[model samples]
Each structure stands twice: as C-alpha cells, then as structure tokens.
Target: MNNEKYTLITGASSGLGKEFAVQCAKMGRNIILIALPGGCTPSLAENLANTYNVDVRIFEFDLTDSQELKKQITLILERFEIDFLINNAGVGGTSLITETSMEKIDQIMQLNVRSTVLITHMLIPHLLQHERSYIMNISSMAAFSPIAYKTVYPASKAFISSFSLGLREELSGTGVSVSVVYPGPIMTNSNTAQRIISQGIKGKMGLLSTAEIASTAIIGTITKYPTIIPGFINKLNHFLMSILPMELKLKMISRAVKKELI
Candidate 1:
C-alpha cells in the first residue's frame, strides 16, 4: 500500500540486483532486499538505506536451498508487505556438454531455474494481496541462441524466458503483472564469465550498465509489458532467430560459440 511495503529484489548484493535496489530506493519504494549471505556488502546496503530514506530490510539466504528460501521469506513478511518480486539471483557455469560434469549442470539448474521458480511461487500470495504487483524475471539473450560450451546456462534461461511468458498469461487481469527481461551481455559478472567462454562469440560492444538494464526492466513492469528484450542489437538478434530454420539456427549458434571461446 505504500513505499515501505513494496519492491523485493533477490540477488540484491551486487551487479544488476544492486542497481535495481538503488533505483527502487530513488523511486521512494521501501525495498526488501534478499541476497546470498555474503553477497551484498554491508557498506552498499547501508548506503542505500541512507540515500533512499526508505525502510530497507536485508535478508540473506541460500536460494538454492528450499529450507533457507522459506525461512528468508518468513522473516521478510514479519516486517512488511511485499509488492514487487525480482527473481534475479543466478550463477555462471560454463563448459562443453560432454566435458561438463552432472554435478555442475545440476548446480546450474538448481540456482538458475528451480530456485527462481520456487521463490516466485512462494511469493504469489503476497503479490495477490496488493492492488497491483509485479514479478520480473531476469533472463539473458543467451536464451535466444544456443551456446554450445555453455549449454546448461542458456537452457536455464530459455526455461525462465518460457516460464515468465506463460506466467504473464496466467496472471493476466489478476492485477499482478509478470515481465521477463532478456538482457544481452550486461556489464556484470555474467559478462565476465562469457569472456572465459571463448573469442569470436565473446561478448563485444559496450555492455549495457546494470543500472540501465534495471531501470528498463522496472519501467517495463510498471507499463505492464509481458516480454522485454533490452538493447537494439538484442532485439535484432531475436528477430533474426525467430525466422531462421531450426537447423540453421543451431549451426549458427554453434559456430558463434566456437569462435567466441576458441
């Protein structure tokens, strides 16, 4: 009902997550910031609390662990009503499919896909209570193309992209909006991971600032757009892929990955 009861962001410790927290504060929104136990630096959180002049509650938990997930939410609800849920916590795991271990793949899926899905489900009731609420899932341009070496990561995002789209439809007319953000090579830790992935397909151009992407996503949610692909080139890439044959698309993606990493 008020700024103090609004805006909950997961992975609020750094990068896009941190940027989202700051932007929400600027909007005078009270933020429920969730991050891995050590993810958000104490200094950063205190600064946000000082600058925004709004209540900033920090929750630290391991999202991949279901038990911890619930506990964190329980603690959060003890203080405020949550309106916006940003499922932004994720990790970077890269390796060729054959070369990647199952343990690594499972870890990637757990954090990137399952945890995100679970947290969203857990917060639905809270969102429903608000006159208007939003859930923004942070996906990647990798969801648009296959990354051979980084098989699991892209696949996880693809799941999120599809999931968010389906959810947007389900929540339609419910006063709870869902927006999926497809950000290309954001200038964050994820981009750093891509650099290790290889060369020709390596991330190039000016990576969009985390603040820019966060602002765009937040604005998109406010405007109730179901799917938002930020950046001109990313939109172009999605357009190109949409019409391409499946085999050709796969081949193109494979070649790009090879060039990018090799």
Candidate 2:
C-alpha cells in the first residue's frame, strides 16, 4: 500500500463536492476527484494543485455504471492510499411520481443509491489498510420526512443515512470512522439559489451555503462525529420534524412542496 494518504471525493466538479475538495486541499491533504465525463474537472484539478501545492488527480467517468466504476476504483486503489472516502455524488428531482420517466428514476437510484453503496463496498479493504480512515456520506434533510413531488429522492437519501449509520457501528472497533451529513437546501449554483430565493421566507429558514456545509463536514469527519448537521436552524428544523407523527410530517411537507410545484 502507498504510504501517502489521499481523500477520494466523488462529484468533485461542482457543488458541495467541489467545496469539499477545496477544503481538503486547504488542509494539505492529497486529493482524487471524480466527476462525470465532460465536466471541467481537469481545470479544477490544476487549480487545486497549484493553489494548495497538494497532489490532485481527476477522474471522469459515469459513476452509475457499476461494472466500470468497480473496475476504475480497483485500479485507483492499486496506485494510491485513500484514507478518506467522500460519497457526495447524487441527483435530486422534484416532480409527481407518475409524471417522472422511468429513465430519470433509474438514474437517481443508480447514481444516488447504487453507486454510493458500491464504491464504499469496493474501498473498505483499502480503507482498512490505514491506521486511521474516514468515510463521509452526504445525505439530505429530506430523508427525515416523506414529501410530495420528491418521492424517490428523499427515500434514496434515507437509505444513505441508514446505511452510513449501520456501517459506522459495524466498523466501530476498526480504525475507520463513518459519518453521515444531513444538509438542508444548499445554494450550490445560480439555479438552486434562484429556486430557494423564490420560496421567500420559507426557503431561507433551512438554506445553507455549500462552503459552510463542506467545512463542517470535514471538521466532523476528522473528529469522528457520527452525524453532522451543519446549521443550527437546520438542526432545529430536523428536531421539530422528528417529533411529529408520521402522517402529520407527511402532510406538512406535502403542503410546502405543493406550493413549489405550482
């Protein structure tokens, strides 16, 4: 095994994934960034390497392709010692279940659920080689409650949250630590920012910047925090939502989403 440690981050071209790459590089950690094919990750890799003076490598591939993903990651593990795995690649959509096409649903499941699980599974042996390792999976606060117009996305995230928690327990005695992050709406891009702004006061309540979430996630992972929920308002909202009856929680979320769908 290579003695130098690196953090492998999926979806590192943009959004929270990009922020995580920046923060990790700032800490002087070598990085391996994976983004979808055709993304501008080469430039990002160059910038990080030059700015932080850390080793940065970029991989562009379809993460949803399970066979190819496994093959590529197997090759990666052979060449580098990855001490941290950040599973931040995911897709989200808002639409009625019936209106969404089968392809879109499959994409969400394959990328968000299948890829995350498969990559983690493939990397466990490599992680175990290290005296200390960390895994941080990005889940959404939507996992807390069922909502209309976003049926599959939230369910997928709930799976991530549960999977991370269970894996954390199973790997307890080992040197590896697992952390699940549940972040609310993040202003990742101008489009997402506009959508949140359109929601008026309701949107602002749970909105968090990508930098804040990334910083908090990195800190939490390094310190071995089991769960990382970034903002105080988001934590409060999660607490409030958790105590409500399931039916009530569903209804409350439905009402809010319905307004957005209109």
Return the top candidate by TM-score: 2
Looking at model 1, residue 211 earns an lDDT score of 77
Clashes of 1: 8
Stretches of candidate 2 above 4 Å error? 1-3
Residue-wise C-alpha lDDT for candidate 2, range 1-262, written one tens digit per residue: 1236899999999999999999999889999999998887999899989998899988889999988899899889989889999999999867788899999999999999999999999999989988999999999998988777889999999999999999999999999999999999988877667666766787789787889999999999999999999999999999988899999999987777766565
RMSD of 2: 1.7
Instruction: Give TM per candidate.
Output: 0.91, 0.97
Q: After superposition, how far is residue 234 of candidate 1 from its true place, in Å?
A: 1.2
In terms of TM-score, how similar is model 2 to the real structure?
Answer: 0.97
- Per-model CA lDDT versus the true structure: 0.80, 0.91
Clashing pairs in 2: none
**Backbone collisions counted per model:** 8, 0
Give per-residue CA lDDT, model 1, range 178-225, as digits (tens).
999988776477557556345433455425778778888899988999
